[model samples]
Target: MSATRICALSELEQDTALRVEVEGVPMAVVLDGNGEVHAIGDTCTHGEVSLAEGFVDGDTLECWAHGSAFSLTTGHPLNLPAYEPVPVYVVTIEGDDVLVDPAVTRPTN
Candidate 1:
């Protein structure tokens, strides 16, 4: 598993997400409502839009393109037009840096 530093923890606001690229793979790093960090695929399963452009409510991340919602923890699609699950990466906060495992993402089923 290859890990890369994407951003600082302080760089992310609460209940918001940031889009990043790790080794050419698009990723969305989110700060949940509980203040926990999560990383998921930036692409919307419903279409070719980016998930980072969507909104975050609690632990659910919704795609702005089609309003498809997904679970940040399991990467499961929670709404229509997006039955297939998206990849979710493992995130670890070390000090102020956000560390991500590029090879450990959960693939869409």
Candidate 2:
């Protein structure tokens, strides 16, 4: 499937997330410490906060508003204050560009 270019890989640092919108869908593209890219919903389910503004540790992104932790790989909440799982998007790297497919989601494990 075709993926939309979110940002350049050079624009993202390891262990950080960059917020982008695809077809009006707010998405968070994360670069883990191990140099892997992950994509998840940008909004925190527990509050009106941005997950991209939160902290990233390994594969988890901790919501700054309610301290809820969400897995970047699965988009599942690993803690309270957020019982709902966020949506995950497909991430692709085309050369130096970071592409994301908001319509395609991987099954949560």
Candidate 3:
């Protein structure tokens, strides 16, 4: 599927995460302090909690339940309890809109 408009760019706050679901796929949309947008799976791999309800430190989103920090770029957990990685979606900004395709994911290394 092609990218779908999830939210407006103006709706996002720096270093904060917003939970969004597109076509039944849940995601966490984050605007980092550096002014870049990211889309990753919202479910924490360790605690199965919402990552959007967690904390954003730089490019990492830390799960509030277990403290597992996932890399915003790679989707890999950087701490204990969460060894699995989540899916990272491609983000496209058009005008004031933030678009994401739930069917599309970026290859992580």
Candidate 4:
């Protein structure tokens, strides 16, 4: 699938996540420590909470609900309270825009 532009790269701060809806899918767009963009499903695998509300440390996305952490690159669960992997998406930076492919699976942000 083709990537869709969600917002400008400058609009998102590093080590932060923004919740966005793409093609009716609830997703989170994260900016890592190196200013790279990554996308993933917003919902926490362990609950109905949004991942955007969680914290971002390096390549890890920590869910605020249960303190579960997931790798931004592989969608693998890194800590307790979460055993299932969250769905990850592909992210691309084109000039000033941040594009994301919600259908593609990715591990790095």
Q: Give the TM-score of candidate 1.
A: 0.93
Clashes of each: 0, 0, 0, 3
37-62 per-residue lDDT for model 3 (tens digits): 99999999888899999999999999
What is the C-alpha local distance difference test score of each model? 0.88, 0.89, 0.97, 0.86
List ranges where model 1 is wrong by over 4 Å.
Answer: 106-109
Backbone clashes in model 3: 0
- Native-to-model Cα distance after best TM-score fit, residue 21 in candidate 3, in Å: 0.3
* Candidate 4, 1-109: lDDT as tens digits: 6789999999998998899998888888888988678888889988879999999999988999999898887887798888888888877888999988777775432
Candidate 4 displacement at residue 67 in angstroms = 0.3
Model 1, 1-104: lDDT tens per residue?
56899999999988887999999899888999788999998988779798988999999899988899989998998889899888888888889999998898
Cα TM-score per model: 0.93, 0.94, 0.98, 0.91
Best by TM-score: 3
lDDT of 2 by residue, 1-109 (tens): 4688988898998988888888888988888988889999999999969999999988999998899999998989999989888998878898999888888998877
- Worst 10-residue lDDT window for candidate 2 reads 1-10
* Candidate 4 pairs with clashing backbones: 73-107, 73-108, 74-107
lDDT of 2 at 109: 70
Off by over 4 Å in 3: none
Judging by lDDT, tell me the better candidate of 2 and 4: 2
